[model samples]
Target: MNMFLINFSMLWSFSFFFIFIYIITIFSIIIYIIPSLKNTINYTKFKKNSNFDYLTGFDLYFLLLTPLILFLILNFSWSSYTISAWFGNIIFSSFQYKIFFFIFFFYSLILTAYCSSFYFHSKEIYDYTITIFNFFFWILFLFSSNTLFTVTFFIEILSTLIFLMLATSTFSTTYFYNNLNLNLHNYFNPTTPFFFIQMLMYFFWISLISSLNLFFFLILFYLKFLTFDWFIFEFIFYFLTSTFTLKDIFFSLFIWFNLLFSIFLKCGLVPFYFWKPIFFKGIPLHALFFYICFFYFFIFLFFIYFLLIYMNEIFFFFLIINLSLLIIGIFILLFIICEAFYLKAFLAISSIINTLFVFLALNSTNFTDFIFF
Candidate 1:
């Protein structure tokens, strides 16, 4: 009789737990959809209120609530959970969660600061929705385990969303300028569809190349170690480095080069930076801000995480490559400072310099030194 009662209680508790999750899921979906529906229904009203435009009630609510949600998730021990499988896992340490929460809170502030700049047009509404969703996915990307495939998947999604957001913003700006009959050709050149096409093509090719390199690296890594988990990869790497055969050295170098090249391409480091200036030239200032502050920040964080995982095995190679890159970055920074007349060019150069400094920081032997630098 006692055993039966215990089993019944366990089942009841499980049912309650699932019910709570279901309720939260439904509530979240309702919260997300209602705002969008409200925006749509009030679109015509918003159009007439253009002169007094500001963030909508929903936007303000989202801005205020997101940080609270993140705080609860980060601080509450009960909110800590991990989903692991043979494929990959999504997890973050308490420290990482705290860092992410603070970063996201600051990002929310930045978004709020720029909220007034976004016009209340139909396309703008779509763009705003995309931006919010993209940020949510970015949070997902940050917490994702260092599984190469999973990381690549997130990268592809993010890149696509960025492209969409930029394109939509450009279109919306062009429409706005046309309606106002502005003579600001220098700000957003609507006449240069060809330039936009070229930029799009270049971005596509570069993204494809980066993805392919990462996929090839993933294949090589899986074949060598027969595992996708980064923790397991670290153990295998340590074991191989202990023996350190010629074949192993060559293989490791190839894998390292592939990974570094892909990350550098994504981060727009010195060698792979040609497309960035052109890309930035076409994007609006707000989009550029988002790209620089949020996108690049997370990519750099990912790179740092990657380095922390494999720093022991690849310290010599990393030191040599990073030093060389740093020297090149300094020269590029100087050249840009001398010749960059445009704001976009200056921003591009600044981003490159920031990336180089991050690489330099990674060379430090101590954690405090790394963080301080």
Candidate 2:
């Protein structure tokens, strides 16, 4: 109880401090904008250019989130972690925070680039709605927690919505299509950038559904196991103990299989992979920069984080499945490279397949998850 209170007080104080700093920064920007953006603000762009002031102001607010994020990271101590905080089981360590930090770092770079480039291209992006969306995406993604519920409730929803708004802003809703039967075209043309990013996010929603379905399968079995008292074997202890029998071993294997496949789907691995080629079209130079540097980097960090958790559940099933995935990933990678007309398509395909290799290496090693930190 005392620890909880201390943590809560710290959290509250930190958040308050962040908010205070952020407010001051906003006022500072207001002063700067009043003088510098005088022309861009009251005239020329929107008939109602005042609309952008608030939006741009909010857009600038994301800058302050960086210091708070870094402070949380700097204060992170792997050995001192508690499973529950004010946010309810949202705090912990192991590969989780390291992976979170890597993800935060990776996404931060892309976001910085995106915001900078977008500001330069702001005159081109005239939609007030898009400005609002751009703000939410940066803020929501920056603050989204690593916990499962937070990821589902915040990141998955906001990320999808963010891209959807971007997608629609760039083209008529009529231009978007499911078009699964359609082979990807325009591999060498840089004309349509959002079209490609939008399609990647479109398939992200589908992959989300598939991952959830498989995740619930594991949950269902988990609930069933609780009736027979399996939590003592699996949850409380980090590893299987001598209290188990052959039957328990097989059940553990089953649970492990569920975990492996669920993560596989989530990371865009084979058997559930479809979005890559569709979005591997020739995008604008800037869009391609963000896509290649940011998108794949985000997914790869996620894959590493997830793989560390379940890689200990070594069974013949895991071995066989991973080997199969590795073979398939390699074949698809080569075929895509040979067939692709553009470098972007090849890069995307190669990055997707490389995630499987990451999984394979982690699974085959006894290096331990903590070593990755």
Cα misplacement distance, residue 221 of candidate 1 (Å): 1.0
RMSD in angstroms, all models? 6.6, 8.5
Q: What is candidate 1's lDDT per residue for 168-282, written digit by digit as tens?
A: 6656553344323222234444454443565677777888888889889889988887866666655655666687588887887688678778977876875677677666655
Residue-level lDDT of model 2, residues 1-373, one tens digit each, is 3556556646754564456447545644454454246555554443344343322433543744565465556547334663433334233445445545665565566556555544322322333233332433333232324444343443344345435544544442222222222334532223454446666665567557755765575465556455322223335224445546767666665665665576556546664454565555423344446445654455454445333443334332335565576677667666666535545556567667666566556655533342353
What is the Å distance of residue 104 in model 2 from its true position? 5.7
Lowest lDDT 10-mer window, candidate 1? Answer: 175-184
Give lDDT per model, in order: 0.61, 0.48
* Residue 126 C-alpha lDDT in model 1: 51
Task: Quote model 2's TM-score.
Answer: 0.57
Worst 10 residues of 2 by lDDT: 172-181
CA deviation > 4 Å runs, candidate 1 = 1-45, 48-88, 174-188, 191-195, 232-241, 309-313, 316-318, 328-339, 365-373
